[model samples]
Target: MSRRPFLTLPNSHFFLASRAAAVVTTLAAALVAVSVSAPALAQNTPASSAAAVTGGAATYDTAGASAVQPDDTNNFDARQKDLDRRSTDNNYRYAVAEHDCYSKFFVNHCLDSARNEMREKRAVIRKEQLALDDEQRAARAQKRDEQAALQRAQDAADAPQRAANDARNAQAYQDKQRQHALDQAQRTAEAPQRAANEQAYQQKQRQHALDQAQQGIGASQAAANQKAYDQKQANFQQQLDAARQQGAQKAQQRVENQQHFEQKQATAAQHKADVEARQKQAAEKAREKQQQQLQEQQQQQQQIEQQKQQGK
Candidate 1:
């Protein structure tokens, strides 16, 4: 007879807890990666990756007599700039949270929670931008294909006209060469005066360019000064906001501390009352036992006296 192997159930609660911890750790690491490396990835994501992201049929917008294809390069460049701006904005928000988290009471928990939130926000924006890029690329590709087909048709249709144009262009080129020779002879005769005029014109252009450059430099310096002032103002505002936040946090912490102290005092008072009540009950029970013992002794004494009277 073949023996059957017995199977036992695994510890489900332990298994679940371990799995949950692993998932949380994984997600936390992913959040950190997204926070730190996301901008670099956005900047360097290759065409193949984009193709993978946009793997579907491209749609085109055609209008009267020509297919208007989207300018993929310009659109993507704009999209990249937008993505960079958003990433910078998101990073700023993260920086604020990170600052708070580090300074907060529960540092690790606050930091982890902030990172997780940042990851979610960044992931959503990146995914949306990538999807848009994919769609645009596909549309551009379809437009190019359409344009190629139109060009081929145009080429076929213009074949006869092209031959006639070639003959006319040959005659026109011969006429132009003769005119060019005559013009060259005239130009040689006038070369000295033309050279003098050209040199004066060039010198005037150089002076004008120098004046414009000086103006540009002055404007740039003014703009830089304005930008520096704006930056200083922004920094001051940020510091002021941070100071206010710190004050508010300190006040909140004080309130929480006060509440905690009051709760502990209340609990200690209740525990003391319970202890006193227990002691009083114990004393009452002891007194009742003593009284019952004394009553029993008195009854025995009375019974002995009655027996003595009977004997007498």
Candidate 2:
């Protein structure tokens, strides 16, 4: 007689208890996972991200639009990091599911279901990540526009001050030039007077010394005359020294004034250069951002085409 293979099952009580425990565990896990991911899922959806991309493209021709978008280098890096983290989490969950599903009586069905669920979850996370990236792009763009407006306002407010500074610098330069010319002319005109003053001083000293020598009427008288001549010489020397000091001081003042003017001019030039450099840097950054955005759009379009082909 041919006998059919008999199927053995667990005791009803044990089976029921095991099933209940699994159901409770699964429910708890589901609740925890839902709670953790709810906000992210709600905020970052494929539809929302697609909308942002469309909006961004629509405003591509707007002024300062490039300023709104940033280079994709950092953003792409962040996205990759997020993708890696999600992939790791998904892998861990898959491993756990594999272990649990294999121990079940319906191992094949359980494993298939678990794998499908993991794939769905992974896909959702990927879509959410993409959406988040788009949102960040939009936020960055908005922030850049705000900053540009603020900068424009600030520049407008500072226009008067900048103009005033420029005028003041110009006037100061003109005044320094005039003073320099005056000082040069004054020195030129004083040359003859300085020479005459020197000649007169020398002649007075010589005559006074001669008169003292000639008045040798008595020893005491001669001594008195010599003393008077010495006093006169001292006075003349003091006057000469004072005049020299005054001329030297005037020259030093002119030099100092010229240096001050030159320093001010240099500072103004450097400030103007700095402002120009900043403007140039801002322009370059904006151009780069726009290029990056265009490239990203192209890449996104290509990806969509590839996805379509795959679906087909």
Name the top TM-score candidate. 2
> Candidate 1, after superposition: displacement of residue 105 in Å?
1.7
lDDT for every model? 0.59, 0.66
lDDT of 2 by residue, 119-235 (tens): 666655555456556767777878998998998899899989989988987897788789879978998998999899889978987887677677656778877877887897799
**How many times do residue backbones clash in model 2?**
1
Taking all chains together, each candidate's TM-score versus the true structure is 0.31, 0.62
RMSD of each: 47.8, 10.6
**TM-score of structure candidate 2:** 0.62
lDDT of 2: 0.66
lDDT for each residue of candidate 1 in 1-312, tens digit (9 for 90 to 100): 132343343457786466456655655665676667756656654222243233342222111112113564456666665565566556656666766553344556666777767766665455545555555656675776688579668867986896686567556656755765775588688889967976886686568557666776677765665577578668867986997698688657756865675686577569758966885786687568557645654664465457558646
Task: Give me the overall lDDT of model 1.
Answer: 0.59
